[model samples]
Target: MSEKMKKIIKIAIIASLVSSAYSVRAQEDELSNDSHVTTSFVKRQVAQNMSIGRAVKSIVSNYPQEASAVVSTALDMYPDKYQEIIHAAISAQPMLTEDIVKIALEKNIASCANIVKTAINAEPSYVDFVVTAAANSTPEELNEIVRVAVITEPDSADFIVQSLAQQHPNKIVDILSSAIEAVPLVGEYVVETLLAIFPNDAESVVSTAVRESASERANVKRIIETAQNFGLDEESIYKYAKEGGATDEEITAALSEATEQR
Candidate 1:
């Protein structure tokens, strides 16, 4: 309550702030010189102000070279803020989207879909980069990643699916199925896209669609008809339709429609 005590408390607060500023400045200087200052600086920022996104953006924008380490440290400090951390990091250093995604996914692979979503949503122009980076980092979640990527940016479905298919040729069926299942309306375009990329894998693409329809989610009728229109033989179409559990009636209707189109 005394004026002297109040003045002394005010001085103490000012001193504390000045010391903090100098400490931060020292760390900032070290960050610019050495990439290793990422952890301490990130921890201090998050501790002082729980703004993970702003903290990440500040460090990355100022020290682009240390973007990877800064992002890795931020994610480790606030795993739940993966979305904010990723968005800010990529926004600050768009060129380092790959490294940012790799770091986030490496820290929380379970958030693979969400991490990819956030990165792509933050930098829509970097959709391809975001996807490939995520795929490369967590190929095990390729299907989920593809699904979320397509859902996030359906317009880029073809390119997104094609890129992943090329990266994991063995997962062609899974990739196509996931893409179509995500945006069924794009099924026709997706099938056409993959067929264009993997011309030799037309049979696989068509069959996967047919099988996907078995779940009653994908449209087997449209897929078969599309394959038939794509110049696939009726016998192969019929075989795959049967194998995919397409009811005889559905197969008949699909094939008949294709024949009518021809």
Candidate 2:
């Protein structure tokens, strides 16, 4: 069997054992439901200063369906301990990062940016996954997720932006804008990254950057120049720039600069 399959089977077996133990406790104590039992169990464990990892693992494994509630409860109880809570939860249910992130966001959508950054910080390898989950949980928070994810894990900016762009095809412009806003130094790289992955959205990508950053002549010229280098034709570039809300003056100046660079 594959290593991943074997690992999954092993985890399943362990979860089954932990669940049986908890089942015995539930029956003995007349616990109402898995959700209540898990939440109460986590709160008790935290109160007693127990191993959060073990507590989280046991509850998440035994009550996968209640993982979100359990995680949310843990985070809500320990508002300042989000990193610790997210880390323990992810370590226990590495594959349930989505649920953990979603629950955290649901509990506190205002902190979408911080939640994403913390989740990614817990498991840097899951930057894309974290960003996707945060976006999925709160589509309205896509821009904030993109901004924070890019800022937190700049190394994964390309993947983060591409993932959101692909998932939110209509929000390509906003995704690009948020990403560039997070790391202005990577304005050109952000443009090229999305354009390369979403070549079909060339107009949207180029024009979005131009229109969004219209006031920043350097940013506008830089994106147009990068789009041109990415092989986007000049006429299409100008046309899309206008469509993207770039003024005739801005487009003229940007195109002139792009041409001058060539």
**Please, what are the lDDT tens digits per residue for candidate 1 over residues 11-95?**
9999999999998788778786656655676777776767889888887887788888887777776777788888999899888
Model 1 pairs whose backbones collide: none
- The clash count for each model shown is 0, 0
Candidate with maximal lDDT: 1
* Residue 7 miss distance in model 1 (angstroms): 36
Model 1 spans with C-alpha error above 4 angstroms: 1-28, 43-50, 214-262
What would the per-residue lDDT of candidate 2 be over residues 1-262, giving only the tens digit for each residue? Answer: 8999999999999999999999778643533364454456666766665766556666666666666767777776666777677877777677888778877777773478888887888777788889888888889888888888888888878888878888888888889988877776567777888888889988777777766675566777677778788888778987887776766776677667777777
Question: Could you tell me which 10 consecutive residues in candidate 1 have the lowest summed lDDT?
Answer: 209-218
Q: Candidate 1: lDDT of 164?
A: 85
Question: After superposition on all CA atoms, how large is the RMSD of candidate 2?
Answer: 9.6
